[model samples]
Target: MVRTAISRVILGVSIFAWVLLLINPGHIMSMEHCHVSDSGPSVSSLHMLLEMNPIASQLTGWGLMVVAMMFPKLIIPIQHIYARSLRRTRFSASLLFAFGYMAVWMAVGLLMIGVIMGLHLLMPGSYLPVTGLAVIAIIWQFSPVKQRCLNRGHNHLILATFGWAVYRDALLFGVIHGIWCVGAGWALMLLPMLLPSGHTFAMLVVTFIMLSEHLEHPKVPRWHVDFRAKLFRMIVAQIQIRLKEAQE
Candidate 1:
C-alpha cells in the first residue's frame, strides 16, 4: 500500500512538472545567436546562453526535465525495489535508487551540452549536424543494439535481502537500468537536445516513444519491422479504453 502511494505521488509529480513546462512560454536558454561584427565569425549563442544562466539554474532545468520525462517509466523498477526491501528501509532504498538513476541522466545532459557547444563552434549557422542527428535517431530506432539494451532494461537482477546490501543493490540496479536506458533512448533524446526551437514538443514525442517501448513485453531480438504495428495497436487500445471510461 505504501509503495503504491509513493509510486502514485512520483507519477503525479512527473505529470505536474511536464504540464508546468508546457505552460511556460519562455525558453530555458535562448539558442539565438547575436552578431557582434558582420565582418568576422559570428559570436556563438551558446556562450550567451551559458552566461545568462548559472550552472545551478541549468542543472535545475535539466533535473526537472529528467524527473518529468523519466520518472513515469521508473515506477515499475522503483516498486520492485520497494517490494524487495524491508519496511524500515523501503523508502530510503527507493529514494537512493531514484537518485542514482537521475545521476546518470544528469551526466548525459552535461555530455550533450558539451557536444552541442562543440558543434556550434565547429559548424556555425548550419543545421546539418542537427539533421544528421535526427537521421541517426531514426536509424537507431531499428538497430539490434538498441533492442538488446531495451531487453536488458526489462530483465530483473537477483537482489540482496539485508541491510547495506539492500541499499547497494538498489543503487546498482538504478545505475545499470539508467545505463541501458540511455543506450536504448539516447538517439531519441538527442532530437530535442539538438533542436532547441521545438525542444518541448520533441521531448513529448520522445517520452511517449520511450514509455511505449518500456511497456512492451520482452522478446528475443525485439527490433523487427512489425514493431511500429505493435506500438500502433497498443496506442489504439489505450485510446479506446480512455474513451470508454469517458463514456461511462
Candidate 2:
C-alpha cells in the first residue's frame, strides 16, 4: 500500500511538472529572462517556467488523467476478479482488457495532441505551447462538451452486472470505469483535434463552464441534463445505424 501511494504521488508530481514545463518552455529555455529589465538582463517569468515543453505537457496531463481514472487497478482489484469469476477467466485476461481500454484513451489523447500540434504549426510562434495548451484548456472548461465531462465527474456510477466474487469486484468496477472514462473525456480529448485556433481561450472557456457546474446555480453555463442526453442519443442512433448496416 505504501509503495502504491508513493507511486501515485510520483506519477502525479511528474505529470504536473511536465505539464507546467510545457506551458512555460520559454522560461525554462532562458532562465535569465525571468522578468522585465530596466537597462538589465531580462528574465523568464513564471508563465514561461510553466510552459517549458509541449510534448512533456501532453504526456504528463494525459498520463495523470488515465492514472486517476484507472485507479481501479489497485483500489478495486476485486472488480476485475469478480468479472473473471463470472466466466472463469484468467488474471492475465483482466490485465489485457483493462490495458486495452487504456490503450483506447491513450490513442484518443495522442489524437488530440496531433490535432493541436497541426493547428499550432499553422500559427507559428515561439510560445506555441503556452498559447495552445491554454486555449485548449479554456475551451474544454467552458464548452457544452466540457459541461458533460464535468457532470460525469460529479455523478456516481451504475453497476450493470451481478453475481461476482468479492475479490473479483475489480473487474466489474473496471468495466464500468472504462465506459465512464470514454464517455466523460471523449469530447474534451477531441478539443485538441477539433479546434484549429491555437490559443488558450478554449481552455479558459471550458474551465469556467466546469466551474459553473460545481456551483449551486451556474448561469450562462453551456450544458444541462438535456445537452448530455441529446448527444448520447445521437451517438447511440449513429452506432445503431452502423450496426444495422453491418448486419444487413
Candidate 3:
C-alpha cells in the first residue's frame, strides 16, 4: 500500500514538472541553442564549459525531460522491486534503482550533446545532417534490432535475494532496463533532439508514442504488413476523443 502510494506521488510530481517546463518559452529557446551553436568548427570542450550557463541550462532541460518522460514507464518495474524487496530495504533499493536508471540516460544525454556539437562543427548552418538523423531514426523504427531490444526490456527476471544482493540486483536491473529502453526508443527520442522548433510538442508526442509501444504486445519484425497500424488507430481514437471533448 505504501509503495503504491509512493509510486503515484512520483508519477504526479513528474507530470506537474513536465507541464511547468513545457510552458517556459525561455527555457525552450535555450534548449534549441544548446543543440547547435552558431560558432565555427573551432569550438572546444573548454569553450563549451567556459559558457557554462547554456550547458547548465541544457542539462536542466534534458534532466527534467528524462524524469518526466521516463518515470511513468518506470512505475511497474519499481513496483515489482518494491513488492519483492524486504520492508526495511525497499525504499533504499528503489532509490538506488532509480538513480542507476537515470545515470544511464544522463550519460546518453551528454553523448547526444557531443554528437550535436560535432554536427554543428561539420555543417555549421545546414539542416541536412539533422534531416539525415531523422531519416535514420525513422528507419530504425522498423528495424529488427529495435524489436529485439523492446523484447528484452519487457522480459523481467526474479530478484528474490537480500543484503548486498538486493542492492546489486536493483542497480543491475536499472542499468540493463535503461539500455534496452534507449535502444527501443532512441529513434523517437532523437526526433525532438534534431528538431529546433516545437520541441515541447515533439517531446510530448514522442513520449506518448513510446509509452504506447510498451502497452502493446511485442512482435517480431516482418516485411509484409504494417506493424504500427494498431498504434496508429489508437492514436487517432485518442485525438478524436480529445476533439469531441473540446467541442463539448
Best by lDDT: 1
lDDT score, candidate 3:
0.72
> For model 1, how does the per-residue alpha-carbon lDDT over 1-248 read when each residue is reduced to its tens digit?
86688778899989987876676434453243335222234354445645654455556666777788889888888788767767788788888788878889889988876676556555645678879998887778887788888888896655687868888887888888889889988878777756747788888888888888887776676456534445567779999999999999
Preferred candidate (TM-score higher): 1 or 2? 1
TM-score leaderboard ranking:
1, 3, 2
- Candidate 3 per-residue lDDT, tens place, 123-208, comes to 55466876887788777777888777777878665564767888888888888889988898876776676665666788888877
Lowest lDDT 10-residue stretch of candidate 3: 28-37
Candidate 2: segments with Cα more than 4 A from true spot: 1-65, 68-100, 126-179, 182-248
The window of 10 residues in a row where model 2 has the poorest summed lDDT is: 29-38
State the RMSD for candidate 3: 4.4
TM-score (C-alpha, index-matched) for candidate 3: 0.80
lDDT by candidate, in order shown? 0.74, 0.44, 0.72
> Which ranges in model 3 have alpha carbons more than 4 Å from their true place?
1-7, 23-29, 32-39, 44-53, 123-126, 221-248
**The candidate that achieves the highest TM-score relative to the unseen native structure:** 1
lDDT winner between candidates 1 and 2: 1
